[model samples]
Target: MSIQTGDKIPAVTLKVMGEKGPQDITSEEIFAGKKVVLFAVPGAFTPGCTMTHLPGYIVNADKIKAKGVDTIACISVNDAFVMDAWGKSQNAEELLMLADGNGTFTEALDLVMDGSGFGLGNRSRRYAMIVEDGTVSHLALEPTGAVDVSAAEKILALL
Candidate 1:
């Protein structure tokens, strides 16, 4: 079952690129006592994610923050290196690039989908959520291969 509104986020370790290397960060550390906007993509650098999904957040990050969001994070099932490179390429300095390496977090949320047909293996479905103090307040999931509901503007409107 995928996570839904009113569900507390599960405890899991995600990775992020640090100066030294990849560093582990816990879901608790991210959502605890904070209002956060988290968006997950199928993969890093894929056309929809690279061209539209990620950039929407990068551009509207400030507006989302202005609505009292403590952090705006982007998550993908890629390694930290690729997440870091993609963040830099998109100038996503204001957004947190989190790597769900090994699909731990995605699996925990019950949102993992098989993408082996496209040679991507297991990955996250496209979704976004507003988490308040570790619990989900709003969730937007794309039922198919479109970036309609999970856009930052939609999230901002929800906020």
Candidate 2:
């Protein structure tokens, strides 16, 4: 079943490119006892992703954090290397770009999108969630092939 309100974050290791280096952070470590805004995208560097999805979050990171969020994260079904480069390209130094390289975390949350049309294989659907202390509090799931629902403004409005 898809994750719903009050569902705990899946216990999976997320690869992150931190200042020190690539580090493996577990869901518990990230979500436990913290309020987080976690957004997922199909892939990094894609058109809609680059122009609208990521930039919205990047520009509104401070506002989101001011709404009692501990951190803002962006996840994609790409490797740590790709996410790292994309973060730099987008000037997303403040957002935590997580590499769900294996899509294990995506599948576990029931959010992976089938990308057979583009031959990209399975990926994550665009969505954003408000997580509080390891459980989902609110979710803004985008419609298939649509981008509006998961925008930062939408998430902020939900908050």
Candidate 3:
């Protein structure tokens, strides 16, 4: 089943680009003892993800932080290298770019979507959530091919 409000985020290792190379970070390390805004995209660099979804979070990151969010992170099914390149291209210094490299974390949440028709293969569905110290306080899941509900503005409003 898809993750719901009040559910604890799954324990999974995700990758991130580090100075040395791709580094692994567990879900517990990311969410524990922190108020985090975690958002997921179907794939990195895809039209909707690049042009809109990710930008919303990048632009509103400060405001979200002001509401007591310790971190604002973006996760995609792509590898760490691609996610790092995309973050730099978008000037997303304020946001955390996490790679769910094999879609393991997405699968664990039951949020994986089949994107084979688009040649994207297994990917995450568009969604965002407020995770406080490892538990989800709010979850916004978008319907297929939509990005309205999961926008940062909506999450900010919730905060």
Candidate 4:
């Protein structure tokens, strides 16, 4: 089953573009003792994600944090290198650009989505959640191709 409210985030190592190179950051390191807004995209630079989803968070990051969020992270089933480039290109310096390159974290959350038809391989489904000290307090899932419920606007209101 997909992750839901009250579920502890799955333990897995994800990558981020560190000062030296791609570095590892575990799920526990991210969610433990922190209130986090974690969102996932089907791919790094897709139309909906780039134009709408990710930008919504980037634009409203500080406002979201003002409501007690400790971190705002965006995850995609792409390599760290690409994630880094995408973050830089989008000016997403305020957000954590997490790279779930192997999709292990997505699989552990049971949120994997097949994108073979679009020339993309396995990917994480579009969703967002509020995680507090390793436990999810709320989850918003997209309906297949929609970005409505999981957009940052909705999440900000919830917070």
- Candidate 4, residue 98: Cα displacement in angstroms equals 0.3
In angstroms, give how far residue 74 of model 1 lies from its true place.
0.3
**lDDT (CA) for every model shown?**
0.95, 0.92, 0.95, 0.96
User: What are the TM-scores, per candidate, against the unseen true structure?
Assistant: 0.99, 0.96, 0.99, 0.99
Q: Lowest-scoring 10 consecutive residues by lDDT in candidate 1? A: 141-150
How many pairs of residues collide in each model? Answer: 0, 0, 0, 0
lDDT tens digits, residue span 31-85, model 2: 9999999999999999999998999999999999898999899999999989999
TM-score of 4: 0.99
lDDT tens digits by residue: candidate 4, 10-101: 89999999999999999999999999999999998899999999999999999999999999999999999999999999999999999999
**Ranked by lDDT, top first:** 4, 1, 3, 2
Candidate 3 per-residue lDDT, tens place, 1-159, comes to: 789999999999999999999999999899999999999999888899999899999889889999999999999999999999999999999999999989999999999999999888999999999999999999999999999989999999999
TM-score for predicted model 3 compared with the true structure: 0.99
Candidate 1: tens digits of C-alpha lDDT, residues 31-50: 99999999999999999999
Better of 1 and 4 by lDDT: 4
Q: Where is model 4 more than 4 Å wrong at Cα?
A: none
